[model samples]
Target: MKRKYTAAAAVTVVATLSLAACSGGSSDQPSATADNKPVTLTMSTWNLANSPEFKTLADGFHAAHPNVTIELKDYDAAQYATLLTADLAAGTAPDILTMKNVTDMVTFASGGQLQDVSDVKLQSGIKGAASYKLDGKQYAIPYRIDGNVIYYNKDLFKAAGVPDPDGSWTWDDYTAAAEKLKTGLKTAGSAALPAYLHGWNALVQNFATAQVPASALKGDFGYMKPYYEQALKMQDGGLQLPFATVTANKTTYQAEFGKQQAAMEIMGTWYVATLLQQQAQGAADKFAWGMAPVPQRTSKTAGTSNTPITYGDPTGFAINVKTDQAKTAAAKQFLAYAESQEAALTLAKIGITPALTDDAVVKVYFGQSGIPSDDLTKFAWAKQKIDPQNPPSPKTATLNTVLSAMHSAIMTGSESIDKAISDAEAQYKNQVG
Candidate 1:
């Protein structure tokens, strides 16, 4: 499965853009229809055995066009960047490569490895589509959008007599709730911590940028100081696990929340599938949990009527530049099919958030078994404005690297918040300028 929490840590790859001598061959097989020729297109995916979205797209597209077959090439999810970089450099990459984020997409496009898919008919509701555009041409089409939300254990909240979040929560409200939960759980002799803040740079830095314009990230990250200060305060108060413990023990947000060790966790929508599957398989304790809108910076963007801002980079598909015309045509067809409403419904049934969302898609998504049926959960899931966690820019890779180190320094108390932010700004300016 794609653990989106760690997506911000993707390696920055600089590869040579040499064309491959050999390309995918088209076959005139018996399965070919009169209008469509028989062809097999190889697509790159990670954790193929667990990620059903890719299989669903491949199957759905193949059913529509019997002449084409999509063969998935799996890579290690954690080492996807390294493996894909090697493949691209060696001219062995699959015909269709999955663009995990805009940063890597920018890199691949800059290296001339991604073909322009500007003509692909994207659904009107597709999010983060503009981030895939490079030099006024579309290079990829987003298939899935995983926005951030706060998942809280409803049973834990009830047990502690703490009111459940109702979609209008500012950061102050969130912090107060955590403090109350900490005291209430301790008084009740429950071992669950108030919240779980995962040790990802994106958790703090990306949330800080959610309400700002994408251009604000270009040469400045001074906006991250307040978010970092709040995170450090939470860690100091023991409301959440410390960064050192989480990093040293390699603890995951899944185990922390699924095992009832934490009452609340702010994570991407992708966790819905994993949590539901884990509950059904008896890997997680049976608990009533619901997703609420992520806490806002202030009241201006908070409430059900207002769209809560969250951060997540859309996952898109791009055709390799080295592929032949027959395979390229087939790949484009697959990309268009991925943005269809039929594809949206298929993904919703499995709890994956598809890019093409509408009333019907929202209905199907909430209709799934084990999914939270509350109005608040539905509102949070359906009414979010997702911004690219890392916008597309040649300088983004360097900025991400510097900010990650800055996060570690601040959270671990090795450097003051101002000092860390200042250092990161200087480092980015020196490297990018």
Candidate 2:
């Protein structure tokens, strides 16, 4: 899933931009028809880097709907929201666009830019329309499921005299192995993405004991406080390295993790396929790394369930309300086909977990070639934790800004954990309320 500044932060941006109107409506509504008239629908997305897979999906959609043409527009992660906001304001936004969370859907839905998709049944045959339902109405479909897993270097584990992690292992066992591995290696025991950037994982992992349930908010920050506290304890206990040390001068998560600089990296399963591809090309040895669930919390009252919870980042297509009705209906048809079983399978081959809820379809889709059977099983197992309704915080973007600064302070020993949390809470309240 594409991480925006969290829902907490995104809400702040929306609030900031609320001063201006973000969409326009045309008086003419084109009639829907099965006519073969050529029509083009513009679609916007944030993953230009994954152009090949996206183009494949687009082509598949076009093939299914011969009369509708899709114009794919790519935007960098940082530039997408700003450009999209501008487009919405000028009444020239794409007919379909990608959204990260409910806050995003609400932002556009409230602005009257998105068409009501509640009545459009998914052609993919997935159950539970609740995943796409927002405020009593449906506006988008769940396209992919993403989650974080403990990706360990198998070679490193064996070298450290630690046994490989089985699915049944507990957090204590994980920490024991990590500590043992850190003794002989130059690298730290394990590494995690910066807390602010990974607030979604933090929220999901701590959902049970959280002051607020994961479902209460449009994004996941309400449950992140305890998660960060756990990280701090782990850092003090030497079970994991400080974020600053691992991230220092590191431009990308893959670069650092790929070099074996960290024995374990908490990352999404989507990157597993890419890593496997790299390993095949001899970029790295056939390391015996495997994924396991995050460790359980120490206290029972803490309510941290080790159900192997992870973050789910589902990207879907949404129609712009400003578009002509004929184009809108055609766009919906294209979206339905794009989200079908065949298209979903094509996406799964490229490491995206198909959003279709049917186990049979998912099995057939991942049963194909290019991806390892073991990895496919792992992906399928992880998909059970997919929580499309619980997206990252809209305040995350702003939280990330604060987190970046706070992380610097913590690593430098310039600020205490209590101070950091207090400061972050203040900023979060300011942004959201």
Candidate 3:
């Protein structure tokens, strides 16, 4: 979901890299296999190298195919695509890669950079398997699904005298809870924040996204206005950290919450891995952490009705089109086993949901003894459809930057919200044009 190429210059760079991707050959010829020959396949992903899931994928793949080796090269999500583009241009691209979302997969597919996975019969009835399909053709395999969830500190909430959130909470409840939590922070004589909002969209757009179908390129910026102004109120009320301070310190939601400096953070389910890893390292066990759904929109909006809706997509892996015959065949075998029901169970054990969203598997994942009994991972599996209408936009990355900058300007007192919005629209047109 992190689109790093949101700046105009970055967009130009992405376009250039895409051209190079287009230069690669599109060989639909079936890859030949050599089961007896030793084969190595590399998959570039943004998951941390220390994550147990990567080990599971590699171990599972290697155990099944004794002659094949799966090497996982990990990167920070922010730098993943930029660094990967370099590797692709240098002819050192990994045999397989995990795109941020369908957007990246589609971009690579359109450029002829990804292998056509049509021959591979994917698991039907899986939540996000078709996310990488374009024009009825498949390009990548959907491996996992991630969406927004509110992670709160149980200790902080108890200390603040605020009640724990329930499944059926709304935006009104969220604001009230935030205010009470702020008071509690002041009462505790702690300068720590009550709520932490990071990333461009998470801070301002999630509310709108939950209420309606919206995207940076084609979305109505006005719907986001209420939250933008609320951000100002939160900053003034000391409920949220100022944008200036956040930018200066380069603080992250994980660090803020893990350090016990923030009471709650609304973020994607992918954080389950970060939190789980930290707990294994005993980094965040001091204060109990729990998950809840994001506040639902109480009212309906354009093309959507109010419910516990949140933003998310099925993110997964794609293979390089230029993979050699033997390597391609090996990669396909690895992908098939890696995204199967067994692999989904493996991911669930660690608090991540695979694209193959099976309720029984998800229930077992949450029922693990170590994790909190009331974890938010299960809420992500609740019966609700993902935002299917908001498809990938070619200029979304660039326009995302524009809106993010606008939010910053208002929060920093550098510009009025209305003026900022006007300016952002102008910039979006200029940059995207």
For model 1, the local distance difference test gives: 0.83
Q: Give the clash count for each candidate.
A: 0, 20, 1
Residue 158 lDDT, candidate 3, scale 0-100:
85
Candidate 3 segments exceeding 4 Å error: 1-40, 45-48, 72-79, 100-103, 128-131, 134-136, 185-192, 280-282, 299-307, 325-327, 367-369, 375-377, 380-391
* lDDT of every model, 2 decimals: 0.83, 0.55, 0.67
Can you give the TM-score per candidate against the true fold?
0.91, 0.74, 0.80
54-137: candidate 3 lDDT, tens digit per residue: 666666555555566666666666666777777777788888887775667766777778888887778765656656777677
Clashing residue pairs, backbone N/CA/C < 3 A, model 3: 6-397
lDDT of 1 by residue, 1-433 (tens): 1374223232222121222221211121122334576787888887665677788777776666666767777777777878898899999999999987688799999999999999887778788798898889999999888889999999999888899998889888998999999999998889999999988898988888876433535657778777877887788998999999999999998899999999999999999988999999999889999999999999999999999999888888999999998788888877887777778888998888998778899999999999998999988888899888777877778877888899899999999988888888888888877
TM-score of the candidate numbered 3? 0.80
lDDT of 1 at 163: 97
Candidate 1 residue pairs in backbone clash? none
